[model samples]
Target chain A: MSKVSDFFAEFVRRNGATISVYLFTAVIFWIAVLIVLPQLYMLDFSFRFNLPPSKIGTEEDVHTLKNYKYLLFGAEGNPNAFNWLHLEVFFRTIWAAVLVTILNLVICYPVAYYMTQVISGGKARIFILCLILPFWINEILRAFAFRILFGLNGPINFALVHLGIVPEPVEFIKADIALYTGLAYAYMLLMIFPLYNAIESLDHNQIDAARDLGSPWWRIHWRVVIPHAKPGIASGCTMVFMLTAGALAAPQILGGPSSLWFTQVIYQWFYTGGNWPQGAAYAFVLLTACIVFVLTMMRIFRVSLGEIAK
Target chain B: MSADVELDHLTIRFGNFVALQDANLRIPAGSFFSFLGPSGCGKTTILRAISGFLDPSEGHVRIGGEDMAGIPPNNRPTALIFQNLALFPLMKVWENIAFGLEVRRVPKAQRRERAQELLELIALPNQGEKLVSELSGGQRQRVAIARALAVEPEVLLLDEPLSALDLKLRQHMRTELRAIQQRVGITFIYITHDQGEALIMSDQIAVMSQGVIQQIGSGPEIYENPKTPFVASFVGENNAFTGRVASADANHAAVETHFGALRGRNSAGLKTGDQAILFVRPEILQLGAGTQGNALKSKVLAKEFEGFASHIHLANSQGERHISFSTSQEEALNISPGEEATVHFSPDRAIALPLGELAHE
Candidate 1:
């Protein structure tokens, strides 16, 4: 505590009242406008009944748990009013997001390892460019681009049919392939850069030492590389998992008829269903789940919160 | 369990640049051998070749009388301790030590037992439970050594592993490394740029420069009887005189220089009028006109006091030649800076060699 005070005192002494006041106000404004205000409004909205904008300022409006109750049990007190569909969509979103996270890891780990460790200067730069170039386009446009590629008569199906890999033009977009692939592609830079950052800092001599001690290639990664990259892997997994769960664009553009993402349901409640309270409640639930998942990942990976922050 | 290593006409070249050229050496089993040279002198390249990291562009490296032509590092009967100790920071010390055994499919209980045994050997029996990051620098060095020893490799290679330590710890670890080598009785190949490290720990030393082995000999032989101009200037400090060989013979040569005709033992056999450099160690060059031969009259340019010894700097009347000799005796303190003095050394104490590249200070 004293150390913190000493630091603050030093800071204030270095930059006197005017500059300090400006900096302090900037921080307060940032936290209030960008972070706390949104969360505060969401919290207030989640605990209230679904009131229209005209009725919002009237005495008939009241704070209640009806929105949350509806989320868990549909309408109140009716046993048959259980919203199994919404529950199914909620769980499916979590599971699909997990699958995409794992798939991205499986696909990106080797590429990242190759780019950082195996490849040399110009080649590594080119590989990084390839990873970043597609993301420069707007994400929604990228999803639509993927939609074009995975359509029934798209290039992928055209090649597969012409090559006789499939008998006819396969319906990739209608089979959830476009959605999953698009999700993995959309957030690849997030995953790759973190893993690359962690792995790049490792000394190459450590790998040589393991090899000289008779360890095979696989065991080297398992014992040395992965353990050293835990913080990176945790950060990557948390970000990718949360982004995939909360992602709205790719799900909307490429999702099949049966693929109803939880964010889509939240969108319906807010904009189409005209229930801002219920939308805010669902969004809050997703936010809490993401926070829990991040903490859980940090625990499993044995990385400290401080490490994640880095 | 150790075996001899033979580098038979080994040559390694990266593109047009030659890293090692036709080097041949036989390192006997159970001996501590060192490759001593400055950085980029191909000492590490030779070590890498022996450890199976680099394939010799030509010739062969034979380990334990087996041709190691196609063998990888992990399969070779050799283990290398990297310059940085390279202990796995994530693993406990015991796990790091046991990693090699685990790779060989040793059971967990046995691996742990052996790790414990090796830990005892390294004098860190209780440190096995600690993470590698938790150990001190010296402790980490010992663990790296123990980890290599756990593999029971026929040859143990070290790549300047002590360079990272402080002066005191490095000096201390030199003795510790020598003791461990004596106990294990394995053919240990150590690479170092520090002459003190090579001379103190190695039974045999190979001095290298410019991708070539200058000389291979025991410590005393290398220090006292350096075969090349590079070696004489490299292995230790020496007073050098560049001149023309006035006269030559198999045993002795006279060099004509600004310091006049200086005679020294000539092993390289320079003919008359050939360029040569004469070398004399400070300890051999003494103050006062006590010698019968090879004496020079000069004025003391300056004096440097180093507690136990005082270095008396001298220059000839022509001011073209300068020499410094250190003496720790009480009588030597009588000579002060800017005083006239005569310094002398015996003929055999100095060595003459045909001119070549000198070692950088």
Candidate 2:
């Protein structure tokens, strides 16, 4: 009790009472009004059915599970029929997110290792600047840029054709390759920075010691480097997975005609279908899946939440 | 099994900086040899070259009569104990010890048994289940030795492993390391800037200065017969006299200085009129002038009473030259500061060498 008061007293002394009050009020307002209130409202809204404006606030407007039921099964009268289309989109979004997370990890690990251990000084700074330069453009603009690059008449296709490696321009967008590529590129920096921060703290002597002990290059990483970088790997994987699954702009801009992402379904529900409650329920389900994925990853990697936060 | 290591005119360069100049040395099999020098004198570079972590820019390194030019560290017949030990904090102590065997696909049970045996040898038996962080500094030092020995290499390389310990533990580990080397009976190449550690633990010492080996001999030989001014000053405390050779003989030279003409052994072959410096050990300087050899008349500047002996600081009549010598505590107590005195030493106890770079504290 006194310790808590002492900490607050010290904080007040450092910032002055007026500034401390302002800072505390701002944090409270941000958390309660901007974040908690909307999530609470959405939770309540998700449990109730949408009604006519006149029917709202009347006996017809009552809390129910119809929104959730509609997700598992189609329309009211057909109880036996399953909504495989929405379910399939949900599973496919999860699968694609996992693939994107793995792709980002595989692409970022070696680059992170090289940046932290191999190169240094101005060379490292320039290498990192090149990585961050692409992200200076807005994500939506980059998605559009990717769309153009992967197009039939773009430079990629032109090179392939000129090189005589393909019979014709491959349908990258229609094949859904552009969507994955855009998502992977969009979140690559997130994975790389965490991995670099983790690996940079490792002692170079440990690597030399392992080699001196007759360990080959691969075994040295398996036993020493990767284990030391576990927390960073977990943090990067969690960020990439959650962001890829919740992503909307890249998927919509680069997805094929036949492809459907779960977020697209929720967007259609709230706008085209005029059903905000159903969209809220589906959003909560996606959030639940993300939470489970993070927990499972933490378990597999044997890392604590605090360690990952570092 | 043991193997001799030979560095044949090895040289290492980083850009324009020559870290280790053209150097040649042959370490005998099953001998404890040490490279002693100040920091950045290329001692660690030589250790790295022998361990296969570094390739000499010129010449070659041969171990056990085989050229080790292209072989990687993993395939070399050597193990290196890093300065920081570099024990894996993520693994148990036993796992760190048995890692080399594990890489060779040894069975789990056999590896564990071998780790246990090594732990016993290091006098830390049954402590293998703990983490490396749990061990004390001395225990960690022993653990590092065990880890290197677990690979059963023909040679072991140590790079100032005791530099991080406290003075007392550092002294204790010097004996422990020497005992371990004798027990293992392998060619151990140790690198250190601490002369005490090198003299106490090494059977043969190679004193280096500025990437050059100045002298290679036993501790007594290096202390008594340094070939260069740097070696004479670097290995121990000495009072130097700067002068020009007045006269020379086959075994002795007379140098004229501000004090007077001083005669000493002509180890560096100084001819007449050549610039030379005479070095005399402080312990050999007697308080009163003797009937033989060189003598200096000086005034006592200060007297520091150490437990075993007292140091007497003195200066010449003009006060241009300051000299120091140690005497018994009773004798130091009798001598008052600011009093005139004459110190004496035998000719064999001093040596006249061509003047070169002298070490500064």
Candidate 3:
């Protein structure tokens, strides 16, 4: 046993540094190929000529810029080709996503701050648990619950009519705005936790000291607490925005035909229209937009998750 | 600049446990006072109560004759320098010093002028724009003081602010702090358990034990005439002889047992048949020959040379009591262990503690 151990130890001693570097490099290489390559492939397809990405799957395929031009401006109304409607659908989805993200921030910030500061101990734990308990259910089931709650003859309209708040029952499911509520509530936990975690970790002594120095409560929160929680707020906003932008199910379920987003369009192109290249190209373009958006927001906020990790 | 703080029958309790009970104190105006006690002795609690962070259950805290009950910490005319210094790490030195004025919504130019003035006063003039994190520990301590003083509080409360510094720095800071207080003329209430700090810096100190103020007096009074046995034992190194009182009067008490009939001062009220403890400082416990007063025939058990003074531990024939002997006399007594020596202490040098429940195990 000693001889074998000695042989292995000597082998490791001779090549430990090189071996460690090789292992790390191998891991990075695997990640780039398996995880990053697929995403990059979608982006490559988006910039390629008006062809679905499935056809371009090869050991080597030089990408092009025609696919983005085709998506931006409709290529001919070819049998299996890009059309002008996809571009419109993409822009509308982007608008809805931005609106959802803004609304999410407006609603989530106060709730997160309240949970962290106004409440504590067991009651706070229970309240937070309730917020996350719904997350245990599948997304489809949660959306279905919202669908039931917002149905024409559901309790909302029933209670509204009883209170004379609204004279007539409103059809909520078919409207695009009604769909955003489902989206917000579905992703509310995501936005809430990061924000609450950020605000929770804020140095409370700093707040108290500011007040003791005679700063008003509003100024204390605005100047000290908010600045300290900026990283948390930005991170939460980023997560919620990305989640909203990537959503495909909510629009398909609650949105009317007029509110069809880019995700549904990609789905229609691939399965219904049997145009893989166009679908892959559109997917790739969306992925690139996400990366660019992340980079831009990080730079704008002057924040890096790396710094936060430290 | 001068406002006295008074605590009348202050009592504070958290849930079922009482932190301070009937804690009464009157800190004179313009005097540097300190609450000197071990940890959890409720000294910091009293400071907090005086500063309005806490409210007594029954009594009231008054500053400059104003009842501070229900007043928030911000509104009270007192500034507290937190133990950790609590200087805003990310803010510039000037910003930290100007925090109090900024909170009050003072104009930027006026506050900056005041901040620069305070920086010079704290001996950190050029460090105005430097970040607080750049300063050393002692500098941070001075910055904390400056920040607290910027509010122009009538009274300043410091809770073990110098407890974090190393020994040499702590000694230097003691003088610096006292000098600053004198220059500023604000009532400084310092809290510390370190005996040397209380001895040198404070104009008056309240020595505490187990949530109660045992004695309050000047440093000399606390060291020389400690009333309680715990105060005597805690304030400095002393050899204590506990025995049943053989005879007692208003002038003197004689303990019949070990250290036999050692006549000490009239310790207020000590009766015969009651137990009594006599305390003698190591410096007062002398060596070399038969002398008057309280003389003990003992043998040198151990002798340790401590540079300036040699500390000799002496034991009697029965070894009933062991007393430390400190002498700067360079006459090397070549005194080995078991060498018989007679130690003497003047009657006036010994203070007798009346046999009471105040004795700690």
Better of 2 and 3 by DockQ: 2
Q: For candidate 1, what is the lDDT? A: 0.90
The better-scoring model by lDDT among 1 and 3 is 1
DockQ ranking of the models:
2, 1, 3
Q: Top DockQ: which candidate number?
A: 2
Q: After superposition, how far is residue B167 of candidate 2 from its true place, in Å?
A: 0.1
Give the range of the ten consecutive residues with the poorest summed lDDT in model 2 chain B: B315-324
Q: Tens digits of per-residue lDDT for model 1 on A1-310?
A: 9999898898889999789889989999999999999999889988887766798879977889888778778875666767787878898999999999999999989988898878868999998998888778999999999999999989999999899999998777778989999999999988999999988888888888888888899999999899888888888888899999999999999999888999999999999999888999999988898788778777876789778667
Chain B TM-scores of the candidates: 0.96, 0.97, 0.94
Error of 3 at A121 (Å): 7.4
- Could you tell me which residue pairs clash in candidate 1? none
Off by over 4 Å in 2: A1-3, A79-81, B316-321
Clashing pairs in 3: A42-A284, A48-A67, A51-A277, A52-A276, A52-A277, A52-A278, A53-A277
Q: Against the true structure, whose lDDT is highest?
A: 2
Q: What value does the lDDT take at residue A78 in candidate 2? A: 66
Query: What lDDT score is found at residue B124 in candidate 2?
Result: 98
The pairs that clash in candidate 2 are none
Q: What DockQ does every candidate get?
A: 0.87, 0.88, 0.46
DockQ of 3: 0.46
Give the alpha carbon lDDT tens digit for every residue of B222-285 in model 2: 8889888988888888888889999999899988976788888997789999999998889989
Fnat for each predicted structure, in order = 0.95, 0.88, 0.40
Question: Where does candidate 1 stray beyond 4 Å?
Answer: A1-4, A76-81, B316-322
